[model samples]
Target chain A: MEALVASAIGLLTAVGIYMMLRLRTFPVILGLTFLSYGVNLFLFTSGRLTVNAAPIIGRTEPYADPLPQALVLTAIVISFGMTAVLMIMAIGGHLEAGHDKVNMSDTDDDTPEVQS
Target chain B: MLTAAWLVDVAASAVTGDAVTVKITHWHGLEAAALWMSLAAIGGGLMALGAYPRLRALWDATPRPEAKAIFDGIIEPLAAACRRLTDGVHNASFSRAVTVAVLAIAGAGVWAFSGGTHLAGDRALLPVTPTVLALWAVMVIAALALPFYHRDRVVALVLTGVVGLLIAPLFALFSAPDLALTQISVEVVTILLMLLALNFLPKATPVESAPGRRFGDVAVAGIAGAGIGWLAYAMMTRQPAFDPISHFHLAQSKPGAGGTNAVNTIIVDFRGYDTFGEIIVLGIAALVIFALSETLLRSPTVTRRLGAIAPVREDGDRHPMMLVVATRFLLPMAMMVGVYIYLRGHNLPGGGFVAGLVFAIAYLMQYMASGYVWSHARQRYDHHALIGWGVLVSVLAGVGAWAFGLPFLTSGFEYVNLWPLEEFELATAAIFDLGVFLCVLGAVLLALASLSRLGLRTGEDVNTRAFDINPDAAQAEEVR
Candidate 1:
């Protein structure tokens, strides 16, 4: 089970990295999403894998680590904030550059650059 | 002679426990005469050596590596190599930099792994059910297929959403119901936000990278994935390096924080300061997005660019009557659920974070059912003010603790037996949770609303009423 979960995390990370390496803003943003999932999962697993051990007191003996859960919980929300900021930046970049390409080198003239 | 005299004075001081006042002349003896003669012989030998020009010249011309020159020789190339590496890795292309960063991280992880002692943990592994295996297979497939279909932006997003959706169930299966709730709600908001942003972005990503370059990226990505995966497995299979502090939290959660849910207690009580900082960050992020959207809308170039792209309007009712009516009823029920979740959070898996998201989703549903113009017209609360009030309320709650001579966020709860109700516990942590709830609600709504402003710029027809076809119009015709 640990192997399965670990492999899933790996695949997500791989896909996320690949997407991040794309030349456009949208893919990069999407890649960040995938990467955050992989990251949150990695952090959560640091508490070690447990089943049927919810951290509510008096509900289960030897509860799963509440610390990691709390950390990941905040992480999930913070990642959302990060993604929103990235999305807006991407939008703004696309508008100013007149292109969605992540790289805006001076030599590349695929689209006319509009001065902001 | 001086050394012999000093030694004699030290002996005297040690015996008398006083300052060194014994005179050298008083202690002078045959040993002092021998010491003076030896010092004179050494001084005369050094003076004779100084007079020898040949010996002095040889000493000056002796061959040795200059420390400065040798240091430069070793450091100059290293400095140039570092500069070259930085330029090559961090060139203008973000993609290349990210690729380099990924490889570097993976390499570092591998290096650390190799340096450590490895032992298969004695802890027994959990048995995987077939259902879990199926979910895992689906998730892996979705993630793997995302890049392949990434050129089709919508498909890629759907695949990404699929991966996110699968994660919630995995959290539930792993005994993190709070995480599961948070993940599902966050996923919804994220996908919705992305969808709004997608309206302005190009629908399909253009293929720019060469096949060879893509293949290289694949290799790099594969290496990173494998490294992280192996690391996670190794860590999960082993016992923690030290005993986890979660036991302490679990033990104190009920008595100290006055909550049955240890996770909630840890978030809102034990680590409330971190949560406070997190909410502040969330508020800042929302403000940034809102500011950017406002700035973008004001730019004539961006406005022209948006105008250039033809709006893609599907052949369907802008606000379907069925969805509008259903959501209208669902809104109140959803709000009630959010309230129930928030109130019961201290004892259950629900908490401020999830409840805030729930409320945001309910409002989001109304926006979806009705057009932005209709929804925006009805929204009375200012999102910015909501965020500010949230922070203020939370700070006030924390400050309330100081009145009792306790530390900030020091929660005090009492079981209240009010008339017409069973006994229930009222906690100051709940007030802190209220602050969390408000901030999250405001941030999510503010961000989504800000993005929707871009949609407003796309020249879509605005709706003044909730539904496209008013139900009362037909009744008015019969009266006429």
Candidate 2:
């Protein structure tokens, strides 16, 4: 299970970074979302994975660390906020510059700035 | 319980300006620090407020025309020259540049892998179960393939959702039901938000990147993936170096906080400051989105694009009959579920965050099924006010603890025996959770509502359709 989770996290991070590096803003944003998921999962494993153990207190059963859970919860919500902000920025950038291309060519003379 | 009482007593004494009987320690010093911090904050706020308007008026009212022209003359040409320079630099066959970059990064990753001393003696005691491995293998493949194949944004969106759903089950398997619940609901909302945004965005990513750039991206991504994967495997196989503080939360949850759900207790009671910050971030994010959408809607350039992208209006009917009818029946039941989830959060798998999301989802359903215009006409609740009230309630709850000389968010519980019913436990945590529930609900609704408002603002006559599954059928009926 641990090995599986680790590899999953890696794969997510790789995919996330690759997408983010795409020339378009949408893909970049998608890549960011993916990266956040991988980070959250990685942070979560810091608590050490426990299967079917006690979540809350009852008898004397072991519990998965609640602190990391709380931290991940915070991260998840914060990431959502961040994603919203990024999406708006992307939309605004697209609006102002026209075309969702993240990178702009040097000379405006080469390609006329087209609106819509 | 005794420690909690002591801590509260110390805080109370400090608040009342009385000498605390507790021994002087590093922790007790925080009371003094809190006082100084508050005083300093007040001073800074007043100074900024007093100085801001005067400074703003001075800058705006007085402008040197020659200085402005001189500055623009120098800066404009310089900026253009620099742009041209950079463009020339990047114009060289980008493919060759990217291949070299990819090779360099890949070589570095290989070198690091071979030289790594961290995992030298460590090995797994037991082999991973085949089922878990298989699930992970599938997830890994999907994750890797998504970005590579993501020409269409919708397919990528769906793929992301699939990954989220897969991860949520892992959370559940790890005995973190609260996380699982929150993750799943958040996933749904996220996918919905993406879908809404995609409505205005281009259907496919424009193929503009050079092949070299794509290859470089892959190399970088591969390196990151490999590094994190190795770290995860290493950490999982070894015992933690230090004692986990989670032990304190798990042990103290029931006795000190009077809640079985340690995660809930930690969020609302033990480490409520984190929750407070989290909610504020959420509220701020929503407000920013709301503000941006309003600005974007007003901008002529964006308005033009929005006009062009107006989804094809096949039918005259804005709101479909079936969806409206279905949502009308489902709305109240969903709200009830939200309430139930919120109330039971302290002791169960549900909590304010998830419950708030549930409520927001329910409200959003109404907007989707009836269109923003219909909902606005019948019921008007200012989403801005909702967000403000939610934040205010939580902040007040935190400050309420200070009134009793207790630390912020130090919840107190009392068992009450009412006339007809059996005794029940009432914890201040519930009030705190209420604040959380409100904030989550408000933030989600307000942000999405702002997007819906943007859709309506487009000068087009298409009354925003409430969920039309088959617009062709509606068009045929109208023709008949």
Candidate 3:
């Protein structure tokens, strides 16, 4: 069961990394979403391969590692924030520079002197 | 109980054996797998059902927007501008609404934090202190920012800077000391630079007109803020899995490397290569700024006195006596505190980050208490030289470590045997600390000086040649 889950994660990671290498903003966003899923699944599966255990420890039951789950939840939110920031910056840059290209090529003459 | 269950499984295993030989079947939990598969199928089926009409109408119904492109291009930017202006004008009432919303959200957040702890069994969710504290801070900041936003633009800008400054503590809370220090210093310098830059811009004004259309701004802001709050709350309920760097810290901290501070140990020893790259990036950034300084300044859009501000005469009056005196008294105290922070950083809550910023504020208060003219006259260092020296010092430290047959940031200590005192470890780590300190102080002042010298529009007209030529040249520049 562990092997299977590991293999699944590996596959997802490979695909996600590949997509991340793409030059376009849209695909990069999609890639990030995919990568996040892979990461969350990988993280969730680290608590040993349990069939019946949900890690939601009740009054009369043994407990699972709840910390990893908590962390994964945070990763989800932070990733969302990052995605939002990335999207906004991308869109704003595209509009201002009049190009949706990933490279900052079009603003050769028009680029604001970015400060240190 | 767990052992009992295992014993029961063993007993069942023995009962099925002829010679006590029991075999677990392959795909034993295949039924559970089937249930999961069915769930996936159901979700896929729902998606297909929803997507079918969209697939059919992809070309026919999804043509470009029916409105004229020109109409949209004109309206969108104008509308966005109008909205921003309207929000700025009606900021007082909007801020009140925000304050209320933030309070309610924070209250709910506290309830959630308590509920999370309560709902947990033996392996209950850990009470995440930082997340809770961060939430509280956000709400507090939101509430506090509103008054300043309504009253004064400078105060609003400072409030924004405070929010950025708070990012350092958040980073520090997460145990990323280097990141925290860098972030705090950068935030301070940037804010100072901003204030100086705004010396050319219009003074902040109260909304003379009736503040209306505020409901739209309030609703939008509330929704956004609420969404963020809930998202952070949901995330706080998650778990921690791994620390990939712990092994390196433990294994290589002593024999492989040398340092008691595990974080600094890792940063200077293991990831020294990354530090080198970052410094290179800093160098490049500085170079870029120098390169673009001319054209960026010369840009047609950067004309002085472009926005018609209510002009003040050259005879600048001092602010109320109490403010000046109060700030004057605070300056020396602040400077001493900054020095203390810088000196005592290695042991306690104080650090180079806070110290450098405290120093900047001390400088800032000098200008505030005294006139800008008086402060400018008392300027000590050549701002350009300070910047160059700071960067050079940081680079030299990195290179110095490299020269010792170690990596770029090889941090270690050599004991100095003095005549009167026992030998002590003068850790090279302190050099990095010093470099950071100098960079922060110098860069901050440089940015302030550069921007403050932009235009003489305020009651801050200098007794310089540019002051005479500027009104006419700047007026012509504004026209063009």
Per-model root-mean-square deviation over C-alphas: 6.3, 18.2, 23.1
Candidate 1 on A1-116: residue-level lDDT in tens?
Answer: 99999999898888888888889999999999999999999999998888999999998597999999999999999999999999999988887787788885747555656533
Give the CAPRI rating of model 1. Answer: medium
Candidate 2 per-residue lDDT, tens place, B409-454, comes to 7788988999899988898888888888888888887777777776
Q: Flag regions of model 1 displaced more than 4 Å.
A: A106-116, B1-89, B474-480
Question: Backbone clashes per model, in order?
Answer: 0, 1, 10
Question: Chain A of candidate 3: what's the TM-score?
Answer: 0.76
Q: Which candidate, 1 or 2, would have the higher TM-score against the true structure?
A: 1
Between prediction 2 and prediction 3, the one with superior lDDT is: 2
Worst 10 residues of 3 chain B by lDDT: B118-127
In model 1, what is the error at residue B463, expressed in angstroms?
1.4
Between candidates 1 and 3, the one scoring higher on DockQ is 1
lDDT (10s digit) by residue, model 3, range A20-40: 433334333434544454565
lDDT of the structure predicted as candidate 1? 0.90
lDDT of each: 0.90, 0.79, 0.48
lDDT of 1 at A97: 81
Scoring each candidate complex against the real one, what DockQ results? 0.76, 0.45, 0.02
The estimated TM-scores of all candidates read 0.85, 0.77, 0.47
List residue ranges in candidate 2 displaced over 4 A.
Answer: A108-112, B1-131, B313-319, B459-480
lDDT of 3 at B60: 77
Better of 1 and 3 by lDDT: 1
Q: Give the per-residue Cα lDDT of candidate 2 at B354.
A: 90
TM-score of 2: 0.77
